[model samples]
Target: MAQMTAIKVRGKRSAKPQEKWTSGKKRRKNIAIGAPSFPTFAALVDSTALNRPDQRKRRRRHICLSTLEQLPTEILQDIFDYSANIELAFTSRTLWAQLRSQHVYMRLTTRILSRVLGYEDKERASSTDLAAATRLLGCKFMTWKLFRSWLEEQRPGVYRNTDQFLTAWSDLRPSMDLVPPIKLLRGPWTSERLSFLRIFSRAIENLLELSPPHYEVALSGFAEAVTEGSPNAVGMLLSMGLAPTTEMVRHAVIDSGCDKDIVIAILSHRNCEGHVGDVSTTNVDLLDPALWSWAEKVRRDGNEKGEWLTRLLRSKFAEIAAVPDAEL
Candidate 1:
């Protein structure tokens, strides 16, 4: 044992000379601790956010270490698979940067949306998995254009129109039955429709809002919004500079209970050159008794507790009624 110790001591002494560098200029100085130089929260949001949520930019990042990071890659991946909130993984820049590269997370998100929505593998297609995975990563990091190309490949035949293409490709769309309330939207819906809307909200958010001009698509998009109980989708379109057609307003009136803000938004933007869209309808005047009856029924139900809506409906009707029939 003493010989071994003597040999170890000799080895250390022999290695010591090799450790010394023959020449050196100088060692680089270390950065100061807690430099107070991290990008501000507002700056991160500005740099990371794109014109649309799906476009993100690489920005200066802040990082923190965690014990979970030491786990083996496969083990940590399994843990990530169990997490429903992808944003939680985003708490650490390293984790977000690492996990997004794993295709397994994409498959995992596919299982989540598919299991909840009851879309079979055959109907939904793998392209949806990729698209939704991009969405799950946060809107800014999404690659929806790539997803759209995949969808086109998946359905070479019926890609007739963008709206239908989206509705069909997503496979997450609410049933037609889920739209229009059972009792004329007396109040917020008490069914599964709202849940569906909220679940897929971000996925469709930019799609409806950022789409280019299309004469025929306005109503179709509005109809999709109405059925989905997501007037905000149409509202987003309005915010994106699409003019509000009366049909859009009518869709809002169909059950303003869930979409009161959409009505307010349209009226607010009415004076903007084309933003208010034409309020023209068929032979029926804006203040038709039947329409008033419908508005009264909606107001009597639960939208805005009935007060504001009732007054607005009556006042608007009175104002429009005074106009000559020819001018209307």
Candidate 2:
């Protein structure tokens, strides 16, 4: 009976070992069913691809940019006012469109003209003063009709007729007490206003200092224009019927820095060919000794324009000499 019991105990131990192995298998099966499978390289790539567009959208939402055209009208006008040149508006179509209004035009013209003419109190300027200033600045775009309309808008019924407006405009010069009046007071003034301003400002200085003869003021203005290297201003002055003298030409070549465009403008004037002959007889020293030396210096300095001016002047002199005094 003792041996049978011992045998029964051994059998029980063997059963226990089998049961332990079965439990271990069951635990491993449960782990395999519950835990996630390791992802493949392609699956990881697909997941990243799915997320990229959303990430890009999030980044895009965080960044913003504003363009010049998006700015307010007042801000645009302020930009125009602060700009170095009125031509800045012409750089872009959007800018030009923004600044094309009559109100903006008037404002810019008034501001720029006042600044150029050295007016301390631009706000105190009258309609007549503004009109005269516009004329002086050679505002080609500001037509008579436009100016009239603008004037009427500013001061209603002040100018009843064109004649009254003309009278007011004409009377502006005397009130300013310009001793020797500007030659071309009328418009179709096509010169660049900025270039005209630079040259005319200097001419005004000369006018105040010299107080030259009635005819000489125009001549002096031309001289100042030429000296300042403004070809357009010189042309405008000449168109105003300024008679260029021998002394003026000589001064332009010798005294004033020889600029090609200015010299060409003077020489190319309709009156220049005839005027050259007239002056040559009166002034024996038409071609000064200094002129040749200046030409040589200009050549040495490698200024092709200056060299061309010297050549043009020489050709003019040669033509004057070839033509008899009878025709002149």
Candidate 3:
């Protein structure tokens, strides 16, 4: 009887705990079904109003989101006043007025133009000014763009006032002793521009200094203009440095249309050098029809000295064509 009673007590205690757990589960289920679930926190947040950035007022209360474009012209002009000076920035009247009115844009364009012209100080510029300069210089349609292109092209009339900006300046030719060795300007070499600079070179000879390299450049340009076969070209070459050969000398005489004084001066220069081969030492009477009579007269006058005239005549000299007579 005692053993059976103890077992019943143990079973009653375990059953009581299980019964309590079942009663708690039933209560929780009843609450879950009966009670209405409130809106989630996410839903609450979603339902509330959010003020967007665009809805916020800009440029003070005067320039509202609704009537920003309808703002007074004077006010607009004042805003972009700096950019107004740049022709490229003010494309339309309304845009010009708007940008001109904005203090930021106005200051920006002014600073940008100054920087492109290399006039503005980098450190002193504001963030707005630097940003404006960057935009203007980089934009293809901007005034700074066109200005740089014109400079690179070396176009005349575009920078006519550039001469006035000079405190003191001289080119590399004559001022070599005075001027420091440095490159002042360089750009694309168009034939027309090269020709123009060649003339400029001559004009500035008195004011400038020519280093050896500069002289070489000028000489090369002159050489390119005239071929060796041309008499005028030969004259120019002789004037520069080349000495005349006896055959060359005689050829010049026969080709008297070319300036003889220039030839003589070239032959006389100490720096002039020449190689008159035996084949080119000949004085040929038949070389030029016009010179035939003079050759005969020379032969007749110097008949007794026949060997000398024969020695003077070289077979190879006949290859030179007479140059058209050119005035100095």
Candidate 4:
């Protein structure tokens, strides 16, 4: 009975260890079944390595953007044609190189001039646009011949008719030979000369409204030109034998917004040479106290051009004073 009992005890102990081993195996199996199905760190590293070439290719493609110089010629030309500003061509050497062809220049000039002359809208140009056009016409690329050609193109038969009319009138009346010759009126067609024509055209239209005498109409046109602050207009009138009276000079200096250009134009004229030094009959000096006062106001107002003009006028006044009456 004692041996049987001892055998039962050993069997029970061995069964207990087997049961523990089975439980451990089952727990490991459950962990394996319930684990998440995500990629391991090793798998992620391998995938990244595989995609490296594709990533490099994408970066290279992003870096290889096309530049303006690489654009097709037609596209570039279209861009230039649409850009109305002449100064745009100067922004880049490539743009300048491509756009400075004679064909482009002529087309660009014509388009800008058309806008200035109000061909598109059939209205007169605004003051701002006219000023901009004047500056554009002063560009190095602009030429008198181009402007004249444009004028003829715009008014085809008018210039020809004008010349014919002038010739016919001179022939019909020999006394009309006293008038300024056709060449002077017709012009060497400078930009300034064209500007004068525009001013004179408006002046004539204004005079016609009042129906003034021919001489008064002509004189008023000259005064209007002076007051308009256009040096070319003033210069043209002076060149056409309009004497620069003391009042005219005083009016330009004191009344015409103290425009430096207009002042210079009047003082530089051949007709003005003798009169620049002449004092007014009203005891006002040609470079009057009123003009100096205006210059001082201009300086206080921070007009650099006006200040420079004042200095020029002072120098001119000094120069005149230094010269003897014998030279006069």
Predicted structure with the largest lDDT when compared to the true one: 2
Pairs of residues clashing in candidate 1: 53-139
Q: What is the lDDT of residue 268 in candidate 3?
A: 37
Error of 3 at 273 (Å): 39
Tell me the TM-score of each prediction against the true structure. 0.32, 0.35, 0.20, 0.34
Best by TM-score: 2
Between candidates 1 and 2, name the one with more favorable lDDT: 2
- After superposition, the stretches of candidate 3 with alpha carbons farther than 4 Å from their true spots are 1-65, 82-108, 111-128, 144-328
TM-score of 2: 0.35
Summarize candidate 2's per-residue lDDT along 1-328 as a digit string, tens digits. Answer: 4555434444434677656644656668867889555679999998898789765564445333248766887898888766535666776777777877777766765554443333332224454444444343344455545555654554456766545554433332222222222443322234433322333332232232333353465565566666677676676566544555666666777787766677666665554344544534444344666666777787888977556766665676666678543443
lDDT of 1 at 278: 34
lDDT of 1 by residue, 1-328 (tens): 3554333444433656556332232111123233244578998888867555567556767665688876676766677777655665667766665566536545454544443343444344354443444345333333344334444554465554456555654565422111111111122333333332333332432233333333235446556665566655555444434455555556566554436666666544432244232333222245545445666675676655345645655555445456543343
Provide the lDDT at 240 for model 1: 36
Name the runs in model 4 displaced over 4 angstroms: 1-66, 118-128, 157-328
Model 2 clashing-pair count: 0
Please give the lDDT score for candidate 3.
0.37
For candidate 1, give the lDDT of residue 170.
53
Worst 10 residues of 4 by lDDT: 174-183
**Candidate 1 vs candidate 2: which has greater TM-score?**
2
**True lDDT of residue 138, candidate 2:** 44
